[model samples]
Target: MGQLSKIEWTEATWNPAVGCTKMSPACQNCYAEAMSHRLKAMGVNGYADGFKLTLLPERLADPMQRKRSTIYFVNPMNDLFHERIPASHIRQVFDVMKKAPQHAFQVLTKRADKGEGFVASYDASHHPYLAL
Candidate 1:
């Protein structure tokens, strides 16, 4: 099942991977930082390392498994393009998104350069489901 989200702009949350690092002055009050720590303290499955950058390959299929259409805020607990997250893993997440066309993915990231670079190199044109 997809995780229902409280975030106003999106219908559900999908953290195929999670965790992020402080990148700038804008990160001074990141809600993810506090949430990760709190989730870790509560023994949340994917937050064993707390706010430290980590990957959860198992969650990659969350969206595909859900039959209903949804708007997914990808990696809401952290930036999807964090320096520590491998590009290959990001691709895996994208591959999942490409397969699940019923959903719209909102992939917001503080690391826009990396995000743009990934977009440039990723071969999405051939995929009928991927919009861009």
Candidate 2:
């Protein structure tokens, strides 16, 4: 499972959704794209389609189940603001984050404008930043 991550900066990985499509030249060397293939080769759950941009609603409650405070790297395998990821789903992700206030989520996305607009609908003062 991706519940715990080996990434040095974060305590754990919360991939409520996984998989993505290459959008630009920078995607050729994407760590996530590489990892997606690796995880797929290893038969990891949630990566059956490799990098096809699939969403996993079942994983949304992952943080709520944990009692310990954590720093989560949200969607390390995909962008939270990807064109295909709907605002309702993002709302669900935020709702889970809201419920699990003990944890801090780090959400990184190339679409900062969309991310900002999405976060505007909610009280996002305590949540993740779209840009670094």
Candidate 3:
């Protein structure tokens, strides 16, 4: 767990999900894809599926555990909004983030086109902790 992240924008990083498909030329040298294979070789518990779309529900609460307010780069290793992932699972992730208001979550996705509607439709009132 990096309380201090090497990523320029965020203070910490989190990956509740991992693995992605090569969608464009930008994905040719994906660091996450390479790292996922290495992590799998190292026998990391969450990487058993190795570059396949795997959800690590156990890691969802990582940000909440940190008492200090911080910024988390959510799913830096994968696109959390991938179309292959269930909408319900994405909601589960949002639910976890909703409970941890002390931290800010940064989720970037190339597959936003597929999930943006769902995000727009989510009831923000019911989840005050989440920004959207």
For each candidate, how many residue pairs have backbone atoms clashing (under 3 Å)? Answer: 0, 0, 0
TM-score of 3: 0.86
lDDT of 1 by residue, 17-60 (tens): 77788989999999999999999999999999998888888899
Model 2 per-residue lDDT tens digits across residues 1-132 = 237888899999999888777777877888988989999999999989988799999998888999889999999999988989998899999988888888888988877888888876777666555333
Model 3, position 131: C-alpha lDDT score: 41
Residue 82 in candidate 1, Cα distance off native in Å? 0.9
lDDT of 3 by residue, 39-115 (tens): 99999877898899888777877777888889988888899888788888788778877877777788887776765
Q: Which stretches of candidate 3 lie over 4 Å from their true place?
A: 1-4, 126-132
Predicted structure with the largest TM-score when compared to the true one: 1
Residue 32, candidate 2: Cα error in Å is: 1.0
Output the lDDT of residue 115, model 3.
Answer: 59
Candidates' C-alpha lDDT: 0.87, 0.85, 0.80
| Preferred candidate (TM-score higher): 2 or 3 | 2
